[model samples]
Structure formats: C-alpha cells, structure tokens
Target: MKIHEWQARELFEKYNIPVPRGYLCRNADEVRKAAADIAKPVVVKAQILVAGRGKAGGVKHASSPDEALSIAQDMIGATIKGIKVTSVLVVEAIKPEKELYIGFTIDRAMRAVTLIASSEGGVDLEVLAKTEPEKIYRKNIDPMVGLHPYEAREAAYSIGLSDKSANDFTSICLKIFEIFNSVDADLAESNPLAVRFDGSLVALDSRITLDDNAVFRHREYYQVDEELSPLEMEAHAADLAFVQLDGDIGIIGNGAGLVMATIDVVAHFGGKPANFLDMGGGSSVESVYRAVKICLEQKSLKALFVNILGGITKCDDVANGLVRALKESQLKIPITVRMVGTNEEEGRKILSENGIWYLDSMETAAEAVVKSAYSRN
Candidate 1:
C-alpha cells in the first residue's frame, strides 16, 4: 500500500527527522489558511500517489496566501497522470544550499535491505540508479545485525557530505532504517534531503510504501490512506491480485510465480508493464476473461503480454477467454501470447485463428511485445 507524502512526512517527523512544517488541506480555503499561518514562501503540492507531479503542473510555489489559494484552486480536482487530486499539501519551502537523496529498500538480488545514498539531485532517483550508478553509494545491511553507524557514515562521506551534515545524515539513515523495519515498508525514501545555507538538513519530500502482507500489524495507517485508484478498486471487487503501474505493457500470467517472471522479463526487454495481474492457479475461463478485461481497462496500454504455464488450468481454456476479451474490447491494442504445457497445440490454433501472434519462449514474447509497444511511439 502506498501512503501520500503528507503521511510519509508525519512518519519522518515521528522518527525525529527534520522536515518542513506542512499542512494537509482539502480545499483552497485551508491552503490559504495554511499559507497565512506559515507566513513564508510555501509550496502547494498535489496529494496524489504518482510521482512526476511537478512536471504535470500538480505542484507550484506561492509566496503569499493569495497565490497559494490561487494555485490550490487550480490543483484541487485536477488530474495528474490519470489520478484526480482531492487534496494539496501546503508546506514551507526551503532554500537549499545543496540537494541529495537517501532511501531504503529491499535489494532482491542481495536478499537484504539496501541503503542507497546519492549526491546527485533534481533527477529521478530511479533514472540516476540506471544511468549514473557510479554516483550512488550502496550498502546492503544484514537484517540480523542492522545498520551500523560506521557503514552509514561511510555512505554519507562517499556521497560527499561534511562533518556536521554527515553526522546528521548518519543519524537520519539509522532512523530511516528503523522506519523501514518497524513500518514493514517495501520502500521509504527522502528525495532532495536538503542542506540549507545554515548547514542544517531537512527532507524536502518523502515517499513510503508498506508491504501489503504486513498491513494487519499497521492497521491504524489505513484510516487516512483509504483512497484507492479506480482500477485497484475494480480489481479488488473482481477478486484479482492486481496492482496498477505507470507503464504501457500489460501483463497476465497464471500463478504468482509466472506473473512475476513475466513482469521482470518485460522490464528486461525494456518494456514497462502497466499492471501486475496474476491469473492464479486453476483459473477458469471466466477468471481469465475478467483478468484480461482488467488489463484492457487501462487505456494507456500499447501492448498486452500473456504468459501461461498450463497445469491444472488448461491452456486451451485460457486462450478462449483471452481471445474473447480481446475481441470484445473496443480499444484494440497489440497482443502477444506464450503458452506451454497441456493442450498447447489447441491454444496455438485458437490464437492463430484470431490473428494474435504466439511465441513459445517468454523472452521472445517479451521482446516482441516490447518492440510492438515502442514501434508505436
């Protein structure tokens, strides 16, 4: 589950991390009041789950209550990246002497929690990680021993921090690590952890994603984070384990293991998956039909990739449902299918009759769909 930035800031403050004072406002009047209360230059940020809000005009700076109110008027009820904004955060804007980033997340390959620190700023952390990995300082922590102070300091110094700020950053890293473990978070990070002219540090923004499996232990947080995307609500009602993503490729496969592998393969081939939709074991035709329909509901998809390893679920049954869903949908997009196991020939025959391409290898199908998706652009 993803929590909004305001909620993440509250979590940060609870750990004694320095953060700019902010107020969560539902409408323009509250923003005006918050701006007047702060009595300083403030940033009006849209409270949406997606990132890149600033470029989408969901975030703005206001020097006075009037400007803040004007910005909030435009921001509230606006859609950013397909999600409507119902609230805005009016926070005191900080003048930074330098900007840096620090985040804690599970490194699957290392099979441990990874602390990543970067001296670079203004770029997306993910992009930085992919493009300029040399600038990033990484240290994987053993869950049993926890994060060591020396390791934290090593990361801070490697990111080019001075004595005072490095010390504070080390403490912040420890606190973030604590928050990561205690909150059962899948991801927790402060982007642009800023150093002010006076040499004090403050987190300019934060993001936190809790593990869905551990939500039972953190039930209190759901009170404020009850809002779900329309797609997620629909998927939940349909009884599909689905999660929306900001990608153009749609993924569907039988079983959690196969779905995960399909998603990774799509990414490996440079295709972004639009959602995580697991069709589950022994899926009936109707279930497969509904799952495909769910992926089709996302109009942004350029191509759909389906990987099915038939066992108890017959490959031919899944194919009938998949073809039916594609034929019924108005928004006709490219699709690639890879099927193996029981009744593969019948499945291939059904797909071939419908003019949908079939590949036996997941990697080959992933490459085809990725190519089809990018060719459109």
Candidate 2:
C-alpha cells in the first residue's frame, strides 16, 4: 500500500518533521486558494504513486496564484505512467542551499530495519547505488534496542553534513525511524531533504509504503483510496492475486510460484506475459472463470496460457472452469494449456472433448504460445 506524497507529508508533520507549506487540491479553484495562502513561488506537483513524475511534465513551477491554477488545470486529468492524476500538491518551492537523502526501510536480507543516508539527493537511489555505491551509508537497527540517537548522529556525520546542520539532520533521521516503526511501514523516505539558505532542513518530497498485512492495526490510514487498476480491483474482489504487465501473452496458474515460473518460461521463449494471475492453491470453477475472463479482456493480448500442476487443486476441475469460460465468452485470442499431476487423464479427456488439446510438457506449451503470439503480430 503506497500513500500519496501529501499523505506522507501529513505523517511527517505528525512526527514534528518540518515540511514545506502545502495544500492538497482537487481542482483549479482549490489550487489558486492554496497558492494564495502559501504566498510564495509554489511548485505544482501531480499527486500520483509512480516515479519520474518530474520528467513526465507532472511537476511545474508557478510564480503566482493564477499560474498555479493554470498548471493544476493541466495536471488534474493528466496521466503519468498509466495512473491518472486526480489531485495536485501546491507547495512552497524553497531554493535549497544543499540537498540530502534519508530513508528507513526493512532490510529483508538482514531481517532488521535499516537507515540509509546519502550526500547526493534528488536522484534515484538505485542509480546512486550502482554509480556511486560508496556515497550511500547504511546502518542496521537492532530490533530489540531500536534506532539509537548516537547511531542516527553517526549516519548524519557520515553523510558529510556541516556541523551546523548535524543536529537537525540527526533529529530528522530519528523521527523518520520512529515514523517507520510506528506506522508498520515497509518504507519511509525523504528524497532531496532540502537545506534552506538559512540552514534549516525541510522534507521536499516524501514517500511511504505501509505493510498491507498490518492494515487492521491502522484502519484510519488504510481508509484512503487505493487507486487500483480496474483489473486489479476485480482480482481483489475475487480473492485472486493478479498484476498487469506490458506483454502480448496472458498467463494464469494455480499458485504464485507456478505463475512466476510460467512468466519466466514465456520470457525465455522470447515471449512477454501480459499479466500474472494466480488462482491460489485450491482454485474453483468461479475463480478460474474470473481469471480467464479478466485476462481475455485485456487489450493487445495475442494468446492465453494456462499452466496448472495440481496437488490440492484437481486438474479436471480446472478444465471444467476453462471450458465453461470458453462457452460463456467470445475468446478471440488462442489458448494454450498444460496440465500435469493429479487427475491429469480426466483433465486431458475433458479438454479433448471440448476440441482443445492439452500439452504434456510446459516447455512445448510455452514454445507453442510464443509462436502463436508472434504469428498473430
């Protein structure tokens, strides 16, 4: 669960972290009012979950209220990285004398919370890690003891901050750690934590990803709209795990591991998977039908691939669902299926009766589907 930047800033404010004066606006009129209230050169930023918003023309500078309104009008309905921007953050555009990066996240490998800091900011951390690994400083917090003040200060000085800014930097890092633990967050980051000309630190950008499993503990935080894609919402309703991707082949499998392996197999055969749909361990006719319907509904899908290795899931049941889906909908795309394990013979018989052939091997089925997709192109 990712929260919008404005919401992240709200969390920061709750923890006494300084942020630029801003207002979340849904329209031009509200933007104009926010700009007037701020009474400074403001930055109009599209409030969306994806990155690279600045490069996608989602961030603009406005010197006056009218300019803010105009920029907000252009951004409100704009799409950035496939997510439509429905809101904008009108914030004071502070000219930073220096910029720094600070973040806290769960370090899965270490099985501990980690604090990461860098002298360089306002850039992608992944690129920084690759290009200048030494610039990134990290400290793993002990779960039993939590993040100590000395450890926070150590990270602050390692980032090469001036003595004047060290205390403020340390304070912010400690607060960020607190926010991370308190909110059950997977990640909480402040990119380009700005140092104003007067030598005060302010968070220029904020990002927070909460742990979805812990949502029950923080019901109020999870009340915000999820902004899920239409297909994703449908999958959620059906209790299936589905993720859309950019490809021509639609994939469905009984388990997450199987679905992931199927995607790898498709890619290995020079084919891309359009989506990942896992019907869970015990798939029923309704689940399979819904998954098939969702995948077939995707635009630009050239072929559908169903790979099932049944253990708890019976192969014949899966075949029944596929045949029912085929009968109910106009499936324009070709389908390739591979079924092995429990009740395989019965499953194969049912598929053959419906004029569909089942492949015995995943490799052959993957190759056939890849060829079919390319031929259609």
Candidate 3:
C-alpha cells in the first residue's frame, strides 16, 4: 500500500530523520496558513500516490502566502497520472547544494533487503537505473545479521560521499532502515535527500510502500482512503484476495502460492492472466461463486482458469460454485478447471454434467486456455 508523501514525512520525523518543516493541507486556506506560518519560501506539493508530480505540474514554489493559496487552489482536484490530488504538503523550500537518493526494499531474488543509494537524485530511480546504471549503488542487506555501521558507511561512500557528509549519509541510511524494519515496509525512499548549502541534510521528499500481507500488524498505518479500482474495492469488501492484471485469461486458486504458480503457468504457455483471485483455505461455495463472479467482472478476460488443490476446501464445493456461476451468467468465455484432493470424483462429476471437463495437469489447462483465448483471431 502506497501512503501519501505527508505520511512518509511523519514516519521520517518519528525516526529522528531531519526533514524540512511542513504541514499537510487539505484546503487552500490551510496551505495559505502553513505558508504564512513558515514565513519564507515554501513548496506546495500535491499529495497523491503518483510519480513525477513535478513534471505533471503538481509541484509549485511559492514565495508568499497568497502564491501558496493560488497554487493550492489550482492543485486541488488536478489529476496526476490518473489520480486526483486531494491534499497538498506545504514545506519550507531549501536550495540544495547537492541531491542524493536513498531507499530500502526487498530483493526477492536475493531473499534479502536491498539498500539503494545514488548521488544523482531528483529523478526516478527506475529511469536512472536503466539510463545510467553505474551511478547508482545496490547493497543486499541480510535481515538476520542486520545492516552494520560499516555496511552503511560503505553504502554512503559508494554514492561519492566523504568526511562529515559521508557520516551523515550513513546515519540517515541506518535510521530509514529502522523505520523500514519496524513498519514491515515493502519500500521506503527519500528522493532528493537534499544537502543544504550549510552542509546539513534533509529529506526533501519521502514515500513508503508497506507490505500488504504484513499491514495487519500495523493498524496505525491504515488509511480509510486508498487507491483501489472498483473491482479491487469489491474484492476487498468480499474479503477475497484479488489483483487485476492486464491480460485476457482470468485465474482463480485456493492459495496465494497456487494462484502465483497458475499465473506463471499461463505466462509460460504464452498467455497473460487478467487477474489473480485466491479463495483462501476452507473456502465455501459462496466464496468460490464470488471469486468467479469478480473475475468475470473484468471485461478483458477471454478465458478463465480455476486451479484448486483442495484440502481444507472441498473440491465438490468449488465445482458446485462454478456450475452455478457459469449457468447463471451464461457467458461464452471459456473456463478451464484443475481440481484434485478431497471429493475429487464428486467434483469431476458435477463439472462434467455442466459440459465443463476438468483437467488434472495445470500445464495442460494453461496451454488449452491460451489457445482458447487466441482462438477468436
């Protein structure tokens, strides 16, 4: 879950990481008051879950309260990268002598936390990684041993830091890691970690992405307002794990690993999955029905795959739900099923009566679905 920049700033402050004085303003009047209180040049930054806000005209500098108010009035309701800006952060504007980048995230391939740093900041890290890979430094931090003082120092020096600046850099890196660890964050970043002319460092901008699986451990961080599409919202309301993707094949499974493997099989068969829907353990007929219904809600799906290795969840229940859903919807979209374990014979019989044959092998079903999805061509 991507929290607004102001929320990230609050986390930074909580961790004793220095940041420019700021106020989260929900209205132009608040922005005006914040600027007036600061009594200096300030930046009005649109607080939306979008990247490249500056290029989108969501960021503006104001030297006076009136200018801040004008900017805020123009900013509120403005859309950046398809997300409307609902609030703005007015902060003391600092002219940095140099800008740097620091971030922490999971390196899934390495099975460790990856610390990313670069002397070149004020730009997208992804673009920088692609365009000038040599300028950035990546360090894989082992969660067991944790980041050492020397390792942080190493990261600081890698980004061309030296002396006092290097020491400060190392400290901030360690501090952000603390926050990342405490919050179960998937990603934590401070782009344009500004070095003022007087040589003090401050986080000019900040954002954190929390691990959705672990967010329940930190309810204090939960926001009533999150960027969820209509389908996603519906899934959330139903207590189902669903993620919409850009493909024509919809996938539903009983477990997260099962769903992920199903998606991989689809891709391996030269097919794309439109969505991921996990029914969870001990799923009922109603749950399966809702999952299928939600999967069909996406207009892009040309085919559907239901892969279930029933244990706590019975296969017959899944089959019954599928039969009910397909018959009720009466949609022409093809659906493939792979069911095994716990009343498998009963499940197969139920599906066969509905003219839907069940497959035992996941790969075969994936291959068939891919062919079906492209058959219209």
Query: Please, what are the lDDT tens digits per residue for candidate 1 over residues 121-185?
Result: 65798898799989988889998899999999999899999878898999999999999999899
The count of backbone overlaps in candidate 2 is 0
CA-lDDT, candidates in order: 0.89, 0.90, 0.90
Per candidate, the number of residue pairs that clash is 0, 0, 0
lDDT for position 227 in model 2: 61
Q: What are the per-residue Cα lDDT tens digits for candidate 3 across 1-377?
A: 78889988999999889999999999999999999999999999998776677898988999999999999998997777778888999999999999999999999999999999999988888999899999999999999999988988998888887887888888999999998998999999999899887777899989899988887998877763446788988998899988888888999999999999999999999999998899899999999999988888888789889999989999999999988888888878888888998989999999998899779988888899899888887
List clashing residue pairs in candidate 2. none
User: What tens-digit string does per-residue lDDT give for candidate 2 at 59-160?
Assistant: 999999999988888889988878788999999999999889999988899999989999999999999999999999999999889998999899988989
**Model 3 — TM-score against the truth?**
0.84
* All candidates: TM-score: 0.71, 0.89, 0.84
Per TM-score, the best of the predicted structures is: 2
Backbone clash pairs for candidate 1 read none
By lDDT, the better pick of 1 and 2 is: 2
Model 3: pairs clashing at backbone N, Cα or C within 3 Å: none
The candidate, 1 or 3, that scores higher on TM-score is 3
